[model samples]
Target: MNPNPLKILVLYYSQHGGTQNLARQIARGIESVAGCEAVLRTVPKVSAVCEAVESDIPAAGAPYCSAEDLKTCAALALGSPTRFGNMAAAMKYFLDGTVAQWLGGELIGKPATVFTSAGSLHGGQESTLLTMMLPLLHHGMIISGVPFSEAALGQTRSGGTPYGASHMAGAEGRPELSSHEQQTAFAQGRRLAELAVKLAV
Candidate 1:
């Protein structure tokens, strides 16, 4: 008999493609684990106008995430570009709508992690990652961060922290991830997947 692979949700919102790249790296890490699959998803852009809207399907990139995706994911990795030391409004908007899942305890006990991209070295990367956990905490998801054993967290000059994987995407726009950033993200993903397997058992 064959068993189903565990699904780990990779969800994020990116404006200049920086955060999205981090999401992809995290997904690669999650998929590296045997019996685990990464389900990459994104949220639609938000608008201040009450009636402003976007197409249900994005013109490019990952499909928008749904409540069902959250319900079914064995684990989750949330990413977003930093906005004044916090999660971007688009990602925040998505999390704000998860009350149904919270009420049903759909995410309780599942493992989760977060990632971010910022224009400057000190551009709230850690703060954004920290704040991103609030909604997951409300959902009762088990949260984990990069361990010191992941040496990249200590050696990275670009972007990396014990809080989560991060990228220092500078003023030019999205640039290739630094080696440390990539390694840290992959490490985080692997860690999350490993914990998910243990928890599921």
Candidate 2:
């Protein structure tokens, strides 16, 4: 019998829609691969207090990420909006809650990638991407980044980095990803999904 299809989880936290848009483009890229699927998930916003006000299930958009989703995923593409050169608190909060999975080594062998969107060109896109990877690295995940072979990396005047996929949203909070940025993000997802498939069996 044929084994189950590979599933690449596209997990993200978006405050102003930029990160969400990037996640969608990456999902499209993941689905473009044969024998692979993209499971989109989101982390809810964190409150200043110890407990958040959100319900167990989100009212809209993708559902909150479950630990099972992380364990069962063939690959992972994590994204978040830039927040002072780091991933937003919400995403970090979600990851911090994954201690059980980390101790179990559930994601140790999975291929992973990172992505981010910033309000400005120099708004710590790369640093934000790097920060998002730290916890995954601690979980022993194999990290993958966009190779320079992708033309978008060279031509993108807006946002395209070898660290991962990125976007430059103007100060007005506009999230019009450039052709290069979008292509690079898609390529990242495709590469992650493909690598996950290769590692699955």
Candidate 3:
């Protein structure tokens, strides 16, 4: 690892692992760039009851994201499983709590990207991705998406979109990604990292 590599934070909320799978592919793409490192973090589940409390650390998967992660990262990639044509409440909850970072301009000008997974092909993946970008835009982040130049964008029959990388997990909420979905995700990550490197310079 480069001692002072550029850090690209990959933050997400996954209910059935589909979004998490997409996040891993994006992280791989980010790490492919020299002097760039991917930091994977996740938001804890939100409960309907206000009294419900989650453990400090998750039982599995990436650890919870911290304010320091937002402050220090050179770039960001956010993902979430789709819910009613929007991002999961857990992710929305996490972003809602970042008012301090917004006030401090912590993420301003950083390159950012969004991704999502839905149970059906038309199950609001694009809408979910768009909803995830709202907070990033409020923070003054530069958002990137999968360009049509990526061959997978044209080839994907299931989940690839110009809005961002996405996956169709079917009703079962499977985690496995289609080949095109993976390719588009990797391309999106690499693009974000490359942009971050250039902007950092």
Candidate 4:
């Protein structure tokens, strides 16, 4: 790793592994940068009736994210499943708790990105991605999208968009990410990581 590499936080909520899968790919993109690294973290679920209950740490996978994680990262890539063209409640709940960081301007001016998974070809991927950025914007974080310079955006018949990285989950989240969608995600990560490094300098 490059000394003093930019640390990009890959924070997300994944249910049934769909969003988690996307998170891994995005992390790969971040690590490709010479002076940047990806830190994978997750948020616990929220309950409707009862207060959210979670252990001190997740049983498996990356550690649970803390506000300190936000402070340390040079850039961010947030992910969540599509909930009626919006971010999942759990992810939103987590972001809502970041007002302390917002007040401190911790994430302001950081380059950031977003991604999502939808159950169908038209299942609100782009909108969910854009909505995910709203909180980040309020924190003054810069946003990035998949530009057309990536051919995958033009060629993908499945889930590729100018809004951000996305994947089609189909019913039960069956189908795998199409090649174009995968490439688009990798391209997004690479772009954001590169941007983070440039901005850091």
Residue 137 lDDT in candidate 1: 95
lDDT of 1: 0.91
Model 3 weakest lDDT span, ten residues long: 47-56
TM-score: the better of candidates 1 and 3: 3
Candidate number that wins on lDDT, 1 or 4? 1
Question: What's model 3's lDDT at 53?
Answer: 69
**Where is model 1 more than 4 Å wrong at Cα?**
1-3, 49-51
Using TM-score as the measure, which candidate wins? 3
Which tens-of-lDDT digit does each residue in 131-184 have in candidate 4? Answer: 888999999999998899999998988887888888888898853677887898
Report the lDDT of model 4 for residue 101: 97
In candidate 1, clashing pairs total 0
Please give, for residues 1-201, the per-residue lDDT of candidate 2 as tens digits: 226678789999987778888898999999888888889999988886536456888778888888889988988999999999999998998899999999999999899999999999999999999888899999999999999999999998998899999989989887778899899989998999889878976
lDDT of the structure predicted as candidate 4: 0.88
Reference-based TM-score, model 4: 0.95
Candidate 2 global CA lDDT score:
0.90
Number of clashes recorded per candidate: 0, 0, 0, 0
Where does candidate 1 have its weakest 10-residue lDDT segment? 47-56
In order, candidate lDDTs are 0.91, 0.90, 0.93, 0.88
